[model samples]
Target: MKKLPHKFQIPLTVAIMLPIMLTAMPAVMLYSTLPKGAALFEPWLDTVTRMVPFALPTLLVIAGSIRFVVTKWLVQPAPSL
Candidate 1:
């Protein structure tokens, strides 16, 4: 498969990543708001936030590779013009 332009990849990655972060955010915040006696993973939550979006880039690469490989083996290539 031909490489997709950044214009497409950027948005594509975001579409895959946003839901993951949204789901994790509340869990993190609720943990932080827990009772004082509870372990405060304040620093860890901060770190997780920064590290969170990173999964998108990796996801894009892996998904693209899988599609490309599957198309090569299982998909019939388009006939040349």
Candidate 2:
């Protein structure tokens, strides 16, 4: 696939990453918190519901911050020699 511009990459990454992380985090957390052999569907649904509102903004901020940090600190300057 063709690559995206840096300006387009941040939002694209956030969009792709947020759903996977959001789902996986809550699933793992709920699994650990819930008793063994207990029902997971209801709890997972509830957790996802509660988490969605907060997760979106948090993920966006995180994605933006990472982009900024990587661009500023990691992307090396061209060699002078």
Error (Å) of candidate 2 at residue 74 is: 12
Clashing pairs in 2: none
Full-model lDDT, candidate 2: 0.85
TM-score of model 1 relative to the true fold? Answer: 0.41
lDDT of 2 by residue, 1-81 (tens): 987777687568767887898888889988999999999889998999999998778866986898689879999865689
Model 2 lowest lDDT segment of ten: 5-14
Which runs of model 2 end up more than 4 angstroms from their true locations?
58-81
Candidate 1 ranges beyond 4 A from true positions: 1-18, 25-47, 77-81
Against the reference, the lDDT scores of all candidates come to 0.72, 0.85
TM-score of each candidate structure, all chains considered together:
0.41, 0.62
